[model samples]
Target chain A: MPSATMLPITDVSACCTNVTRETISAENAELLARSLKALADPARLRLISIVAASEGAEACVCDLTEPLGLSQPTVSHHLKVLVDAGYLEREKRGTWAYYRLTPGSLDAVSSLLATV
Target chain B: MPSATMLPITDVSACCTNVTRETISAENAELLARSLKALADPARLRLISIVAASEGAEACVCDLTEPLGLSQPTVSHHLKVLVDAGYLEREKRGTWAYYRLTPGSLDAVSSLLATV
Candidate 1:
């Protein structure tokens, strides 16, 4: 398994300007599409909602699995996709892994949509 | 062939609130996911950006193909998906078809994202 402490480097929002502001470059389209693709799954969308509604916009892996009715590996895979896309951040506290929305992360996507 | 004047009815945005504000229902997740899935492709994203940057946030089918390096049918198909997903509106001008982003349509999706 990869180390849990590494911070995500793909902040897709920062890489693309608002789509409405101009004709997006092909590269930007691919980058933004990658992020949206991560969010396109129903389970992942619900996982984001559940975590965002949790106290402090954070939840442990334990709290997520039961509510999502998915196995730990499946939930973790979805969470990892969100993390790789820069919507969620992961932190290890002793034995459990906690996931939190990157502050204003969802807003970045909303703001991009508004640019149109 | 279908008439171009018919308006879209999906309006997926109005069906769901911010994901951050509540735990999204399974149905809403499916709806939102469907819209996001429509947007997950790079070609579709670029098409939206091009039309949005055009006057009135609109573009004709004839104006889209060259810039996109895509065939007219392909562009039209993507536009139809976007229209069905409630991001774009279609209007017929004589024999040609024009597409425009629904007024504040992008903002509705943005607002939903903020709800998360």
Candidate 2:
């Protein structure tokens, strides 16, 4: 195996092909579909919004549950999905877990949808 | 019932609340979620890309099935979902139905995802 320093760094939120400008390959389409699926839920959307609207665009699990009207377990599950999909980053600070938008993640997806 | 002339015009692609700038209301989250659901499938995403890359950013139903490698009926179903979700508009020409991206639909979603 190559050393860590020899490995190429990949940007998870790197820009994708503009869907309107050209035909996206099957692989790219599948990847994008998965990302969109992670985001295509009302609860998850609200969670992201709440976290985004919080101080410094970050929030703890304790703060999210009440605003979303979702139980802690359910909220944690959605947070996991977002983190797995590269849309959010999770951190454990002492006891509660904090979540924040992954830099450039939403913009990369937004750029893909841009027609012009 | 209101008179035809008195009916309000609704822009299907109207801008939604910025998810990163503020907390999105439940109603708005539901609406946006529905739109994203319609776009969260690989076949449907590929279908959109193919049509958007076609001449004049439009394509006939006949041209879509082949690239998607899906049967005509399946492709038609996906097209219908996109059209119903306001991402594409369909027009029946004598022999076939043509589809094109609805102006501002993608951009509206893009704008919602813009953090800045």
Candidate 1 chain B — worst ten consecutive residues by lDDT sum?
A: B1-10
lDDT of each: 0.79, 0.78
Binned by DockQ into CAPRI classes (incorrect, acceptable, medium, high), candidate 2 is medium
Off by over 4 Å in 2: A1-15, B1-15
Fnat per candidate, as a fraction, reads 0.79, 0.88
lDDT score for residue B103 of model 2: 79
Per-residue lDDT of candidate 1, residues B44-94 (tens digit):
999999998898767899899999999989988999888877778899989
The superposed Cα distance between candidate 2 and the true structure at residue A81, in angstroms, equals 0.4
- Angstrom error at residue B103, model 1: 0.8
**What is the alpha-carbon lDDT for the whole of candidate 1?**
0.79
- Taking the tens digit of each residue's C-alpha lDDT, what string does model 2 give over A57-112? 89999998998898999999999888877778888989978999887778877788
Clashes of 1: 4
